[model samples]
Every structure is written in structure tokens, then in C-alpha cells.
Target: MKLSDAAVKKAKPEAKPYKLADGDGMYIEVMPSGSKYWRLKYRYAGKEKRLALGVYPEVSLKDARERRDAARKLIANGTDPGEAKQAQKREGKIAAANTFEAVAREWVENRSNDWTAGHKALTLRTLEQDAFPSIGRRPIAEISSSEVLATVRAIEKRGALEIAGRVLQRCSAVFRYAIATDRCKNNPAFKMSEALKSPTRSHYNTIEKGGFPKLLRDIDGYQGSPMTTYILQLMALTFTRTGELVNAEWKEIDLDRAEWLIPAERMKMRRPHLVPLSVQAVAVFREAAKLSGDRVHVFPNRNDPSQPASNAIILRALGRMGYTGKMTGHGFRSAASTMLNENKSKWGIHRDTIELQLAHVEKNASRAAYNFAEYLDERRTMMQQWADHLDKLKAGAEVVKLRA
Candidate 1:
């Protein structure tokens, strides 16, 4: 028999257990202590299962019966109500465990782990100094666009426009993580661009073909350590980026083969580059091979061989030489490209070959596929002639290749 709501609320304990039936597998079990519970007793797959709702008077007869009817609907539609409740509970546990901050920390940890020593330090420092203080403890989903704008404005106020741009991007990453786990609705950082100020470009001192001869003479005069002098010399001859050249491992260079094999991972293009070496470049690497304690880097910092030199070291060297914006550590490539293209006839180095070695994006499909090594007979002679041009400039001789 169905129990009345008034009777269920006013009834006292009978010092024994009893059941009040609501029909169709729905019933309320009353205990001796006057505690009551809503339950549905049913059979599925030739087995009986009892699905429990909340205890009654707390879960009133009407509400319990309504819940029972909903369960019945689910069962009629080929679903197990008990199994569904358990699945919902499990999902609750996962949602509780994976808070916004928890997921963001996980994302930061994995990315920071794979980074190089320098990059690892930089990323962690940025997050700790700027991100963690504000949103580290706050659940990621709880973070609003205004909160993100606050972090970015803090950077902008300090006159760090580039750094502010980077921080905004990182905050967007946190929002992406929040949305993936059903925490937030969508990314707040997208439309928040209006909060940021306009960007200003800091132009580097780029050397051009017209200024090549004058600059080459100045680079030959950079008064610094034997290591810095040799590094500058190699930078000009090979036209390799200063960072790639400095961080180069001895194993990548084949002095006998007169070639430097830059691996794919180290390169900006993420592809291996075979730099055809001249005799002068090979001599420099051979000289560099003598100094080493344990670090595998060819041109490691003088004080700490375990790491590479700071950008300040090269920049300082440039300052002391009176060649301050005239050329930079990165300008050597421009110097080579300019001189090679200027005297292609005398040097015999093709524009395509020079651009390919420079690692510029060669969109011409046919030209991109041409292998300079396949034409070694022609290339070997050309590489030597190219080295001779630099040697003439380095000797303070009149550089006739200087085009007005």
C-alpha cells in the first residue's frame, strides 16, 4: 500500500523494520530507529538489483515515487538505473579531482620538462612570477577574461610589450585546458585582444650588400678572446647562425670530409643541413677541438664549459670593436649571401645553392629538389673560390666585388 506523506512524516518507530509499497518495484523501507530509505527492487539479466535513493522523510514519498518512475522509464528504454548512478558518481569523482589549477599545472609540467635548460628556466620563471601568484590556486574554469586582462596589464604597465604578448598567449593555453575537461565554456583570451595596447617593432641593425666590404674589414678587427675571434671568423666564412655554430657538437663536424652536418632538431627549419666547408673553416674547427673538459659543445662558455656563452658575451665583444649596429652575431649570413650573389661569376656559387644553404624557404619545387652534393665536382671548386673572396677581404686587400 502507498504510504501517505502526512503519515510518513508523523509516524514513530515501531521497534521493528517494515516496508511501504508504492507498486511497480517502488517501495520505502522503514527501520526500527524510524529511519526510512527509498529503494526500487528489480530483476535484470536473470538477477535482482536494489537501486537506492535518499532516506525518507528527507526523500518524501511523492519525490521517491517520482524518482522511481524516472528509473522505470530508463529501465524500459534498455538502461540499468543502478549502473547509471554509479557512472555518474565516478564522473563526479574525476571532476572533483581535476580542478582548473590541477590541469594547468599538468600542462606546464610536461612542456617545461622537454625544454632545454635555458628555456626550462625561462618558462618556469614566467609562470611562477606572473601566473601562479594570481591564478595558480584558483580553479582554471573560474578564471574570467578580466582576470586574464589583469595579468596582461601588469606586464604592459612595466613596459614589457613583447613579454605581455607572450603572457597573454600562455593564459589562453590555460583556458584551452579548462574547456577540454568541461570546466569553462570557451576561451576568454580570444576577444580580450582589445585590452592589450598596440605592438611596437624593435628593428635590429641589418647589414646590406652595399655595406659588405666596409663591415667585413671591421669584423676582422673585433678585439676579443681567441675563441670569440675564431667564432666571428667562422661565422663569416660558413655564414652559420652564431647560436647554431656555438652550440655545435664535435661529432657533427667531419674535418676530413670538409663538411659540417647540422642535425634537423638543432636547425630552425627542423631539417639537417650539410654545410660544405672550405679549408679555412676546417682549420678553425680543428683548432677548436683541442679545448674541452666534458661538455660536448664546440664553443662553450670559457668560464663554464657545461653551458654556452650568453648573448651578452657576443654583444659586448661587438661593442668593444666599434662595429656596434654595423653588424651582429646574426649578420654573418647576410654578409655571405650578399657577397656570393654580388660575385656569382667570379665565385661561381649559384643563387639557388646559396639560398638553399641559407635555409630560406625555396617554394620553387624543382629548384628545391636539386642536390648540390650530386654535383660535388662543380660545388667543391665553387666553395673554395667563395672562401678566397672572404680571405681577400679579411687581409684588408681591395675588395673588387664591392658593388655600388
Candidate 2:
């Protein structure tokens, strides 16, 4: 029987502090202290359950009726609202306890001290941009292979093939990090290499990228960040990794001496590298230093002053100028290795010095192990000439090299 509001009003204050005479599952319980709380009565799994509907006035009789209808629909769908609420609470607790984002942060802090600040920032940026939106809130142990594959495939759809590849590799490393700590037993991201295979036809080749001087001409016109332009130019001159170049500290440089000392930890071979700075290389730093303020890194992220630009910053800048098909950050090495070796004498640069400057590991382990001679003096001279070669290109002069 549905009792009218007027009837309840006539009997409520004197008899029961509050009661739902006409409502299905709504009532106000007035405590001994004279405060009222709304309660919802429902039957679930063959038992009656009382669900709190919040405090009265806050959860008024009209608002309580709306909530009652929502709960009843859950029951009609075979879901117990009370049990679902408890399960949801458990999910929230577990998500915070074991989320993929949480474990990855742990991995970055714990397992990645060897990574330079530049690399660390880049790694985190990739995760935050490409991976987090989809699965960051999921428990680390619950991120399925399908979820990861979907994320990378989405990057591929945007034509970031190389970035997709790197994301796959880093995602695999994070899951491995989780496994090492026993946070997860199975790597859903493991052995899924074929999923990333690109179908788009590439019309350009990396090995032959340097022979195309027109491409270099195109790069000269790129109006992207001047820092990125200078960066690519330096990569060509030094053949250093993008991370190393951007993270170059002022202390490591000697302008009067024409040298840049990259510490052993920063080198790929885990040995200290002496870059004999060319005239142009020295000039590049002086300009970069002024533009970067006193920030420790040569190329700090514009959006974030704490660290260098992400590894993709230069590459993406290249992409904006249509060089994505023809070149990459690592491609500068191939260009230098090819052009330097091909035109050594033509530019007054020496072949032995160019090879030594490249630190091209002598293939034989025995030879490399025995080799302590880093050809410091000759490489220094040759690096200056190499920088001059680029200037010649800018000036349209023919390359002239010394007789070997």
C-alpha cells in the first residue's frame, strides 16, 4: 500500500523518528543523537541486505527514490548492487596495489639508474603518451597481450613505425622488470614480434641515405626548432647517439682544446669517448649553451625544464620536414661512415682518422681488446676537416681530401 506524504507527516514526529510508509526501499533512521541516515532495503542472492543511501536531506526522499530505481534495475540484470559495490571497492584497492603504471614507476626508479636523465625522461614520456591511456590503470598482472598490442598498433596507425618498435621493446622490458620482482609470472608482451611488422612500402634505403645531397638541402629549409636543426648537424659531425649529444654538459667541453669528453657510462661501449671537436662542433655548443640558459643539458625539453627533450624530439622534428622516409637519428652514423670513408682524401680528411673517430670497434674481439690507441691527435684534425666538408656542401664547393 502506498501511503500519502500527508499521512506519514501526521504520524512520523511523534511515533517513529522516520519511516518509509509509501516508498519501496527508502527510509530515514534518526539516531539517538537526533541525526538521520537514509537506508535502502533490497533482497539479493536470497537474502535481505541493507544498503546505506547516505544522510537525510543530503539524500532526500525524492533523491532516494531515484537511487532505488537504479538499484532495482541492477537486480533485474542479475547483479546484486550490494555485492557489486563491494567488488568495485576491492577492484579499486587492488588497482592501486598492483597497477601497471605503479610497477613501471618502480622499475624506472630501481632498475634504470644506468640510464641518463635524458633517456629516463624519454622512456617515461613514451609510456605516458603511448601506453598509459589504455592500460595504465589496470593491475600489472592483469595487462593482457591484446591490450599491449592494441596500443602499439594504434601508434603504427599514426605512421610511427620506429616509435612503435621501440614502444614494444620498452614495454617488454617493463614486464620483464615486473617478472624479476615476482609481480607477474607471464609476460603478455613476450614473443609478439610479428605483430609489429609494417606493411607500408618504404621507397628509401638507410644505407644509401647520404648520397642524396638534395635531402640535405631539404633539411636546411626545416623551420622546426633551431635546436633540432643544430642537433642533426652535430650528429652528422660527431656520429654520437642522440641521448649523448643532448645531454652534453658544459663541464665536458674544452673550447680552447677543441675536445668534448663523453664519460664512459654515457658511451654505448661503456668506455670514455673523446670527441675531437671540430671548429663547427665547438661553435654549435657555444650557440646551444646560450639558447639553453644554464640548464645542465644541451637540449632541454621546452615543455619541461628538468630534462632534455625526449629522444623522439629530433626524429619527430625530422618527420615534420618529410625526412622520415629517408633518415633517422642513427642514420647520421651511416651517412658519416659512408661519406667520410668515400671522400676522406677529397676533403683533406684521413681514412684511418675517420675510422678511429667513428670508434668502429675492430670486429675481432682480440684486436679490440689489444687496442688501447684511440688515435686522439689525428682524429682531432680529421674531425675539424669533416666539419669543413659540411661547410663546403653548404657553400656548393667540391670536397677536397688529402692523399692517403
Candidate 3:
């Protein structure tokens, strides 16, 4: 008999298990505990077999019949209904294991060895903050380009266009990894090359050549902490990125050799950078050493001696010296690049040495390796001359800016 909703609901259990036949090998097995479950009885390979459809009321009489018919169709095609069900269960488990977050995390773990600690932490943080919450659980193979675009657009809506672009890039990298590993057939993020809003380009505020002397003088006469004064002085001499300068360790410097060897992990280019410390720069470090005494970082924070000075320390000092918009912490690098490139003839400095010192990437692999070893002798001379020129400017000497 074909089962009806009321009949299934009213079918009560007895002392022994009973079966309510619903025809076509589909029946409801009523247990002594009053649990009713739908089951299908069919023959496979000339043997009798049973398949559990679902629990009653939840599965419903109508749905159970539909499932039974579907199973019968599978049986007609010489396929075992029980085997097909198990296959789907296996596929579901595999899909769960191949979620976007799962594959992305795997990819990150595989590449973590090549990335700096900060880069790895920031990459994971970005995904956790942006990508993971939205599409992290979705199967990598099932995710579409439109879904990826939507996630990126949500970030764009918050006015973080650059971050949105970066999130898309990270997703693209993960998707590519998935493709290579056979977890995904396509990279959804690949189609989003031009989908995001372009970020605006803004130059860092820098002091003009005419005002460079006063800026140096103000730094020299800074009434801040001893560490702050030396920080400003060292920043001018090395012209490295502010973070690199702040996070510098005493072990990285060799005052006797007049060199500060910043490790590859701390450098923006992920390559060890050699800064030929000038006589004046070395003097500043000597003062810093006395103040830092027994600290790891050359410029440890005054509040917390364990960490480097906060980035705000440098910016705040510049503001106190009355060069708010006139100059910035990063402006030192720009100013150095501009002034050094212009005075190349006067100093006999090569452009390649300046660019390499700036830690800019060389696109050609062979040339990059050659350049890393090249011109160390020239760079040592150039850094000393650069420092001397700054001293001349501070002393109010005639330091002529050469014509381009």
C-alpha cells in the first residue's frame, strides 16, 4: 500500500518491530521505541538488499516515495542504490575538506618558509579580516568569479580600494594553488583583474632642497630624548624606510667596520641590505648604544624596552620640529634619492648603486645577483660623501644642487 502522511504519523509501535509496506520495495520500519524509519528493499546482483531512506515525519511519506522512485531508476541502470548513496557521502566529505579556507591555509603553509614572518602574519591577518568570513567555508570548486568579485566589492565599499585589490590578489594566489593541486578547476579571482576601483597615487610630502638645511638644523637641535635625536640623525644618514630604522638591532651593526647589515627578513625587498655607516652615522650609533645599553633593538621604545620605538615617535618629532606637511618620516628617502641622483656628477656616484642602496628590486635575475656584489667599494665611498654633503648643508656651506 502507498503510505499517506496521516497513516505514517498514526502508525504506532508494538512490542515487536513491524513493517508498513508502501509498495515498490519501499516500507516504513516501526520499532518498539516508536521510531519509524523509511527503508527500500530491492534486489542487486540477484541478492536482496535494503537502503535506509530516512526517519519518518522528518522525511515525510511524499519525500520517501520520491527517493524510492529515484533509487529504483538507479537500480534499473544496473547501479546499486546503497553504493550510490555512499559515493555521495564520500564526495560530500571530500568537498568539505576542499573548502576555500582549507586550500588557502594549505597554500600559505607551503609558502610560509619563503616569506618573512611579518609578511606571513599580515597575509593571514588580511584573509581572516576580509576573505574568510564571507567565502571561507565555500567549496573551492563551487565558488564562482562573481562570488569572488562580490567579496572584493564589499571591501571596496568600505573605501579601502588598495586593500580590496590586495585581497583579490591573495584570493587569486590561493585559487591558483588550488588549481595546481587539483582542488579547483578554475581561479575565480582571475576574472577580476580590472573589476576593482583604481587607487589614487599620492606622493609623500618632502622638503625642498632650499629647506633641507633648516630641516637638518632643526633635527640637530631637537630638544627631544637622546634616542629621538639620534633617530632623526640616523634616518637622515641612512635614508632607509622608517620601520627598518625603528626596528634596527645592535647585532645588525658593526661599528668597527662602519657597516649596518640589515637582515633579509627585515628588508622590504627580502634581501640583506648593507648600509655603509658614515663616520658621523657611526658616532650617532655610539651615542645610541650608551642609551640602549643591554637592549636588542638599537632604538628600543622608552615605554616598553622590549620593542622598537613606535613609528609615531619619528613622526611626532618631525611635527614638533615644525615640519608637519613640509616633510615626513618617509620623505627622507625621497629627498635622499632626489638630492643624491642630482649630485651624481659632483659625488661621482653611480645611479645603480643609489637604486640598489634604496633596496629597489632588479627585474633581471642574473643582473640582480651581479649588482648585489657589485660597487660595494663605490657605495662605501658614496655613503661617506653623502654624509659629508649633509654636514656641509647643516654648517651653512655652499652645497650647490647640480643641474639635471
Top candidate (TM-score): 3
Count of clashes, each model:
1, 7, 0
**TM-score of decoy 2:** 0.53
> What lDDT does each candidate get?
0.72, 0.73, 0.88
Candidate scoring better on TM-score of 1 and 2: 1
**Which candidate's lDDT is highest?**
3
Candidate 2 Cα misplacement greater than 4 A, ranges: 1-95, 116-118, 157-159, 199-235, 241-251, 262-273, 279-331, 337-404
Give the Cα-based TM-score of candidate 1 against the true structure: 0.55
Clashing pairs in 2: 345-401, 346-400, 346-401, 347-400, 347-401, 348-401, 348-402
Better of 1 and 2 by lDDT: 2
Q: What tens-digit string does per-residue lDDT give for candidate 3 at 1-404?
A: 57778888898889999998989999999999999999999999999999999997799888999999999999999999999999999998998789999888898888876566777889999999999999999999999998999999999999998899999999999999999999989888886869789987434778788999899999999998989999999999999988889999999899999898888888765678888888889889999899895999999888889999998888899999888887888899998999999999888889998987888778787776633446788888888888888988998986653311
lDDT of 3: 0.88
lDDT of 2 by residue, 109-184 (tens): 7745556565677889998888878887788898899999998999999989878888888889889988998888
Which regions of candidate 3 are displaced past 4 Å? 1-43, 46-69, 93-103, 128-157, 168-198, 204-212, 319-328, 368-374, 399-404
lDDT tens digits, residue span 10-70, model 1: 7666768877777888877778887888889987777899999788767878888888899
